[model samples]
Target: MNGLRKGSLVTVGTGIQLINHITHEAVQSIRNAQKVVHVVNDYPTQRYIQSLNPDTESLNHLYGPGKPRSETYRQMVDVIMGHVRSGLNVCAVFYGHPGVFVNPSHAAIEMARNEGYEARMLPGISAEDCLFADLGLDPGSNGCQSFEATDFLVHHGGFDPTCSLILWQVGIIGVGDYIADGRPSGHIGILVEVLREHYGSDHEVVVYEASPFPYPIAGPMVQRTTVGRLSEATMTTMTTLYVPPLATKADRDMLGRLGLGAPQRS
Candidate 1:
């Protein structure tokens, strides 16, 4: 028993694009694991994962029409844990960063650690990374704040309009169950109403979706629309809303306290 190999778990991300953005470390983890369980969006990526490991299994079948996503996530965690308990090294792969907006990955890792199993997560490119490159916007230029669309509306306070605001899952805002069509069934009208108070009707916003395919195959969807017209914009399960910051003057008092003059802007 003492000489037997112990169970371990490693979670990785396949990034937004199919196969193009997978990291070397993530690839190694997938290739070396005894079992590879994944939840990738595209068929090509699913095939790619299978190529890397013959023992690959998909958790996508857990999702069903009208099923609560919370239950699906719970089931996914249980499947991953089952592999670990059998003394097999398991690799769990998710689309985009495994740690970003992935409920099952975090839950599985936490549960594994709690059960005295070795578990860790590797970093991968997220949708936000692709957004910055495709949109040519720098988060450093203005501070960035990110939140789920529903959470932002429910706990709408202390969020600065002067900084770049990103609201994820705008299409599925209030929807808790899985749907086949992945439509914007959520209350998008409520989101538009709330944003109108902060940035006004004419303020431009982007309805963006990072392409799951490689470059030349497809490019990201970037729909620039005003706050007033957001309700009419195209939104899907993959859509993320990008709200540019409102222009504001610098704080003269803080500059004075720092003994600095006005900084030049580009």
Candidate 2:
């Protein structure tokens, strides 16, 4: 048992853009790994990764119609760990931040650690990061709340409407399995209903998709629409829902407790 220790694992994110968003540490991991398994969107990015390491392979074929994405993710973890257990320095790369809603990367890292192998995840630019930049939002000012679109629909309670809200994976509600043709998401109307309880039907919301390219080259696409019209809006796989803050009065009681006297409101 003592002699069985072998291999190492590192998970990295290439981010949303081509080469602009990837971290230097992530590129080094890809360059030095004995094996690399990745799932990226375009052929140009794929070729770049292959150029970094000839051992690079893609896990895109694992997805199919009628196959649960959870199953595919589990298979990805298994494949990544398989290489790690075989005395190879394995790199698993995903499109966005490796730990942000990336189940397989987290799972593989946990599995590798449990098996007594070294494993870690490197940070990369996520859509949420781009969202703040493109929208000119300072989350520090008003605070922010984030959740998956489906989970927010069913389980969100006590959520403050005065703070900014970010709903991820808005185009894939009620979708548990992979769909090959990439059809429009079906349950958006229900999502609108849930949000309407907090924000009125006329409350403006942004249906946003951060562009894969950097700003000005091809900027982030932002569509400002009311909550009522969100159901009618066209959504793709990358769409995210941003619900801006509503008006709220400041709590004078809390302000006094903090020893800060009431200042003039801006």
Candidate 3:
């Protein structure tokens, strides 16, 4: 601790788009911080943060090819904590929702709190938020479930086929370490096999990736492929899989229990 001064940490999101997605409060936090550390994907967003705070530093340098992602995340937490321990007002920025699919942000906040520092995360629009908007999807319409691809496969999670499914990290399946120049191997095949069991090999699915830039894009890379073709599809770290619902099954016994008539097809 520097003197008796209190050090605080605030995590904020840049959202999916460069400048447009950041909230007014998030920007103010960046402007007011003594030091800012950011982890973002695009150059324009990084430049904007640098312009807002001249003391901005990027945490991206912690990442390396062949390095385990967990190691990189630990390094990120160390960097954030290092500034806070120095009694500086630190604002850490991450692209999209800081808490969503980001392990380091949560870890940093927890560590800071454990150290008797004021720390919290501010919510921002995530890729899923954009997906719901650009794709005209209402999760309430049929219910929706989202999961990490590898976790879903490992746990053999059960999902309702009548509800929509969104699988994130589809491209980096089974990849424990970071590979800057190469993609993962064999995970896609396993994913396909698992999905085929539930939805059948001919069941249609869509691969989606939200655009970080503004171009009035209607939808992501919506590939209409069967479960069997998932391994053959073009995918990236950002790719997400969308599986539409199967046919709604009538439950006459349940309807009768509720003193209601059976469902009629429109």
Candidate 4:
């Protein structure tokens, strides 16, 4: 501890689609780091990281069948911090935006900073970013609400039906463990039940997954179905459910208070 050089940490994301989606800054961080530890969704990304720096290693081995995801995240933090404590300039890579739905990346950064090591995170393209682009939806058009599927159900907070709703990890709701096959949890039915309370049985929803490859190679998966048939739809670990806003009218009272006339209908 006394003789080791000062350690530092930087976490970055590869984005949903590799190579193209990843920022140059993130790529340079991976290239310059003394050690790189990553958990990417696809094999192509893994190879790309290794190509950037031969010292790159995967954190995927930490995940095991039936292992609690929380435990795996803890172990990942430990490993990343271990490298930092050894006086290595460590780069931690994740699939999506490092700060989005990634527990270990945040934990490692916090630990590194607390232990007097320089640590920071860089932003990357996220699944939601791709979703917005692929679906031609603008959050500013109405409003947007996002939630983890289990949290949406467990917390039971009322959401706006007049605005868009996005539920992430819908395929794995209520699943706390790592499954080898990326199986859908049985709890999705519960999510359907709850969503129906807000959107109704006949409300049309989209089940979407961003393609790991670029458009020419593979397009994003977009499945349209009614809320009533959601339980019967195929869902995977990466699926995100999009519930569009219902028909909504502007509040004339509020518009009048602002001294503005009613918004012209398009």
Q: What is the TM-score of each candidate against the true structure?
A: 0.95, 0.95, 0.90, 0.94
- In model 3, which regions exceed 4 Å deviation? 1-5, 182-184, 217-219, 250-266
Model 3, 101-127: lDDT tens digits are: 999999999999988888999999998
Model 3 lowest lDDT segment of ten = 213-222
> Best TM-score goes to which candidate?
1
Specify the poorest-scoring 10-residue window by lDDT in model 1. Answer: 1-10
Better of 2 and 3 by TM-score: 2
Question: lDDT ranking from best to worst?
Answer: 1, 4, 2, 3
Q: Work out how many backbone clashes candidate 3 has.
A: 0
Model 4, residue 11: distance off in Å is: 0.6
- Candidate with more favorable, higher TM-score: 2 or 4: 2
3 or 4: which has the higher lDDT?
Answer: 4
Q: Each candidate: what lDDT?
A: 0.92, 0.88, 0.88, 0.90
What's the ranking of the predictions by TM-score, best on top?
1, 2, 4, 3
Cα lDDT of model 1 by residue, 1-266, tens digit: 54324899999999998899999999999999999999997899999999999999999999999999999999999999999999999999999999999999999999998888889999999999999998988888878899988889889667999999999999998888997797786499888888999999999999999888776758889999999999999888999999999997888998898887995344
User: Cα RMSD for candidate 1?
Assistant: 2.1
lDDT of model 2 at residue 188? 92
